[model samples]
Target chain A: MDEAAIHGILSRLLMAGTLPGSVKLGEHRLAEIFGVSRERIRKVLHRLGHERLLEIVKNRGAFTIEPDLREGRVVYEARRILESGMAAHLADNLTEAQIARLRQHVDAEADALRSGDQPTWLRLSAEFHFLLAEMTENPIVQRQAHELISRTLMLVKRYETTAGSACGCEEHRAIFRALAARERGKAVKAMHSHLSLVETRLRPTICVEEGPSLEEVIAHEIAVYREANGAALMAAG
Target chain B: MDEAAIHGILSRLLMAGTLPGSVKLGEHRLAEIFGVSRERIRKVLHRLGHERLLEIVKNRGAFTIEPDLREGRVVYEARRILESGMAAHLADNLTEAQIARLRQHVDAEADALRSGDQPTWLRLSAEFHFLLAEMTENPIVQRQAHELISRTLMLVKRYETTAGSACGCEEHRAIFRALAARERGKAVKAMHSHLSLVETRLRPTICVEEGPSLEEVIAHEIAVYREANGAALMAAG
Candidate 1:
């Protein structure tokens, strides 16, 4: 329905970073973009608002979400658990077809990177694990993997990529190698390390400009860094 | 809010086998139970349909999910990947507090078992590891634990208590001991083995009688499970 269409456009916008943070987003703009009705856009906006992906201001319009520190950690916490589980399953019964699909995906990512299409590369790189989860032939795992991927996406967008080289083809290469060897333990370890390395590559910091504090949203992400870097960050803000 | 309430009741019915597959759940009956209207019940039904926890027939009604052979394997495949990652994280930071919490969860399950509260015991046993995921101090791990827990709940409900005791409390206690002893490597191994054991406990041969297959209602228990099981059982189911 209209909701699905809205999801398509909003997801694309999210990926493109066209609508980030607390910018006002009118339904009319979305309607015009997709040649849809304002009513349809509103429906999708409401759905996204409920999921915390969009902030809907009363009498205003939808805006992007920005999680505080703690919430950011929640994003990573979810990714770590889900991704590692996915890696282990991939260890169990990896098929040549699945490997081929993954290879194709990585190849596409490399091509994207070479073309300097960072967005496509970023999406493909992030989706590689989900593609792996799908191959595992487990809906439960796939579902969990799906949720983690969404959360991770949000977290990555929030921090914006300070380290810059977020795409590590070698990391994917190492993961596939372990899988090829049928070394389940090693693969799981590599996956865990890969996620950590990927996360670390994004400097665990955000510059909050002069504005109303977003303490609640960021609490989950910042809980760990508080009493250490929190004070300075707040002072600077 | 009503949607959350409906999922709570639906999950209960499924896990308790009160509403087995093939049974027709009339909207009136469910609405009566929830003290809501038929219109609201219908909405809830559709939402559960989204989670794959319930299946809504064109003319019949919603029923608990029953995965076919192919879908069943997909569930396990998904869990393997998700849990493996969790196992790695657990291995990396198998702290004393976390170990204590896990042991405490196990001990409570033992007490529940001794008290002959089979349902409570079964639910708690699953929650033990899920709670363990939280102690990894990672939200990603926690969220994955939650999704995997839901699938596990569905799997256990269908296949569990068919032959074996409610849960392998002994296995949980044993794993707790390994974890408490600061044997990170062994603990991770034990966790993988524990998940494997649980997977084995599933009906090696699934026969979908008359319920909605799990993929139909994935996050059906967001309210009750979280409220009842707290963090632990929430993760397990």
Candidate 2:
């Protein structure tokens, strides 16, 4: 599989709580299931490690990193800085279509929330912020914002249990309205407040002592991967 | 050798112009010289690739990235944001000893400039900004700032010649004075202006279409690495 495909699958698993924090990734098993060499798996693992999702140890291999309280705060702090900067840029740069897309995303987020689908809701909420960053058209800021968002996902998965309104749909709508109205000050303010609400909702401390059956999780993902890409699987070999 | 040690050596060489951009790394030669396995060398290369210093190819090998004008601007933009944040924090939190260290570093920069040593001068100038970021004690910001600063070093080496005072020693002193006075506003302004000057001084379209003998350069570094670590080299294996 290509690195981006692997990255997507791994990221989804991470967000879905299938690969919980503190889980040790068995590279050999992953390689076997993915029908790829251990080297390709290692490359993917290295990329995730660089993203702070996995911690690579010498000889011991890679493990999903457990986000602690300090990291949780740091991630939010970075988000505030980057997102605030992004909101300002978006105020100046976002096109009507971009604003419309953001509104559509918020409607989807509301649907997910109303359906009580916590995972989709959470992902969409994160995506809303990421979309704002993406609209800024600054790759460097986008990359850093993505890193912060992904790491925050680890914390969210660990701490969040049920549907929460920390990143409420209404707040997202308010931020979008401000952006649509081209109110730069209001947009920045709304973004900062939204992030603050999100940060506040995170538990004071959230850590999983251990995860169950990381191997089984990998096996399940392999089945899903095969079903998703029957043709690509044959093409690779 | 450990990844950190390898990283240090490669960073020094890159900054000193010993390993120019566009130079392909010889993993086998590096493994042989370091008395480490190819796998270990690959690990280090992967780390550097993640840092954007090395561009790794699948069937091919890793090569130092040739920073373009666009990348040059992006690096400076990232620096301006991160460094300004850092200067604001440092102005409030810098200890008396930290101020002394800043003065001492600028003295070194001035000394390097006086000696007409462009490499040392360039590295020290970058180090000054890094030191400022380090004082913030925020690892996330520090890591991002360091990445930008190091990448800027690559651009400086490729584009700079004859020590044109992009990062003038007086500007470093001005920043230090602001920090020493605990003037947060002035410190941030000084940092922004300093960065602006540095960015302005870079050639508009700096690109190295070609470089000299990369193999000989790698060979020379191996000799230098061995001489510098004769004791540690024996201890490792």
Candidate 3:
């Protein structure tokens, strides 16, 4: 596999919080799993470390961060500040088409919730913030928002119960409604409160002690990644 | 000098807009100037490239970016969004002591302006936003704000005439007043308009063709860095 493919699989696996906090990602093991050289795996691991997705220890292998509630508070507060500003900006600046697109996204979130598709609802709920960031059409804002949102994803995956994610769809819709109405203050308030609520929803869960082996998790992530890129992989080959 | 010192000097030099955009930063040349190995200079250059401070061209060398007015607009819009959120957060969160500190800082700016100390006023003006970011007490917000603020410093250096920066003190005082009064919406509006006014003040100036040689700029930056770090360096030695 190429470095980007390896990085992508590892990034998703890490962000999904599937691996236990105690599991150290050994370069040799990753190289064997990906059918690549150790050097290549090492490079990708260090890159992920730089991105703060993985914790790189000198002489020790890479490990997943065990983000505590304190860190979660910091991350959520950051999102509140950034996305609130984003909300206010979009309130004043979102175009008619952009508003319609937001409405469609919120509707999709509602539909997923109604259909009892928990996974889809969760993903859409996260994408709602990302969509707002994109609509800002500012690359810097998009980049900053992407980093904070990605960090929160890890936090959400680890701390939030499955039931906790269910109510987020409505919160996202509220934000969308405020933005659509061009109510800047309301939109900012909605976003800030929604994120604060999400932060409050985080409950400490025991890291899975025996859920899945590292190898099993890696294989599953690789398979999911390949399936998602199947058509592109085929075309390239 | 260490890699960080080298990086600091180069960063300040580049951000100061002393070098013409067309000047290529050759590794060997920088190595000689800093009395470091070419490899060390190469590393610092690439690091700066990663930070978007310098552009590293394939098979060529690193060069300063020539940010146009269009790029300035995007950056200012980003600052407005992020700092507006910051202002809102501070409006709700600034403690009495923090408010006092802000008051003192604004007073200092006004004093600097009255004393005809344009340079001090300019530096204090930029630090006002940074101070607000630091007051947010959120590392993520601080990091994001620092990056955006640093980018604008470059834009301000390149495009803003000296006279244009003089009026920013009052705008900053307006933001401070709103934040001190804990007026969330007013604070956000003050910040947004202040940044918009700053952006509108940007004017295209011809890149100086013969102001100073690259060596002179680097030497001057190094001297400034040394003077700033004199105490720390002396302590370490």
Candidate 4:
């Protein structure tokens, strides 16, 4: 597999937070699993390390980040500051079409929640913030937003319950409503409160027990990745 | 000099916008000037390229970015989004000591401007934004603000006249007053308009005729750098 494909699979696996905290990822084992060389796996691992998705130790291999409440507070506060700014910008600058698009997205989130699709609801909930970032049409803001959002995903995956995120649907709507009305202060407030509420929902006492082996998780992630890219791969072939 | 010292000198020289547009930085020439190997020069050049301070063309050498009005618009818009958020954050979070520090800094700017010290006023003016970013006490926000601020410095150097920046002192006071009063909306508005005004002041027709040669500029930067680091070097030696 190409480096990007391996990186994508490993990135998803790590961000999914299925691995127990501080589980070391042996490069040789991963190379064997991906049918690639250890050097290629090492490169991807180091790239993920640089991205803050995993922690690399000297003389030791890469390990999944152990979720800490202190770090979670920092990430959530950063999001609040950034997304609040985004909310204000969109309030002033969002076009009619952009507002309409946001409306459709919020509606989709509601539908996913109503239909009892937990996974879809969770993904859409995260995408709501991403959609707002995209509306800014600013690449720099989008990148900053993406990094903070991805970090929150890891935090939420490990600390938050599914029901906690379900409640976030209303918060998203509140932010969208404020933006649609061009209420900059209200939008900023809604976004700030939404992120703060999300942070408060993190339960640090909830310890995850045994999970599937690293090999199993990597295999599942690779399969999902390949399936998503199947049509493109066929076309390329 | 070490790689970081080389990088710092080159970074400052590039951000100073004293180089002619699209000026190629020859590796061998820089190696001779810095008394470093060509490989070290190449590494610093590539690092600057990654930071968007310079552009590295494949097969060709690294070249200074040609300041474009279009790019200036994007960078300014980014600053408005980010720094506005920063202002809002500081409005809610600035402690009494931080507020006092901001007051002192604003007064310093006024003193510099009234004394007909354009250079000091200009530097203090930029530091006002940096001060607000530092107040956030969030490293992520600080980093995003720094990158946008640095890019704007490059733009301001090439596109804005000195008189335009001199007018920015009052704008800084407006932003400071709003933040000190803890008015989130007003602070955000002040920051957004301040950045917008800065952007509007950009004159695309302003063309720099000529600058010092690359070697001369590099040598001057090295001298300034060494002077600044003389104390630290003495301690180390």
Best by TM-score: 3
- Model 3 CA deviation exceeding 4 Å by range: A26-43, A57-61, A211-216, A233-237, B37-39, B58-61, B235-237
Q: What TM-score would each prediction reach against the true structure?
A: 0.73, 0.79, 0.92, 0.90
Model 1 spans > 4 angstroms off: A24-43, A46-52, A55-63, A67-70, A104-120, A154-158, A204-237, B1-7, B26-29, B56-61, B67-70, B112-120, B137-144, B203-237
lDDT of 1 by residue, B56-174 (tens): 78778887666443555565555555655565566556777776777678889989988888878877876776777667676556655565577567667666554475558887776
Query: What's the best-to-worst order under lDDT?
Result: 4, 3, 2, 1
Tens digit of per-residue lDDT, candidate 4, span B155-188: 8878887777788888989998998899988988
The residue-level lDDT of candidate 1 at A145 comes to 64
Candidate 2 lDDT (Cα, 0 to 1): 0.75
Q: What is the lDDT of residue A69 in candidate 2?
A: 69
Question: Which pairs clash (backbone N, Cα, C closer than 3 Å) in model 2?
Answer: none
**Tens-digit lDDT track for model 3 on A43-136?**
7887788677889898998998887789899988888888888998999998999999999999999999999998898888888888999999
Please give, for every candidate in the order listed, the TM-score of chain B alone compared with the true chain B.
0.69, 0.82, 0.94, 0.95
- Misplaced by over 4 Å in model 2 are A1-4, A35-39, A85-100, A103-118, A161-167, A170-193, A204-212, A223-237, B1-4, B15-21, B29-37, B85-120, B161-193, B204-212, B219-237
- Flag the better candidate by TM-score, 1 or 2: 2
- True contacts recovered per prediction: 0.97, 0.13, 0.77, 0.62
lDDT of 4 by residue, A1-237 (tens): 898899988887877777777898899998999999998898788778867889999789899998688999988888988898899889999999999999999999999999999899889988999899999998878988998898888889888976777789999999999999999889999999999999999988668688788788888898899898997889889
Query: Interface RMSD value for candidate 4, one decimal?
Result: 0.9
Question: Highest DockQ among the candidates is held by which one?
Answer: 3
Ten contiguous residues with the weakest lDDT in model 2 chain B: B204-213
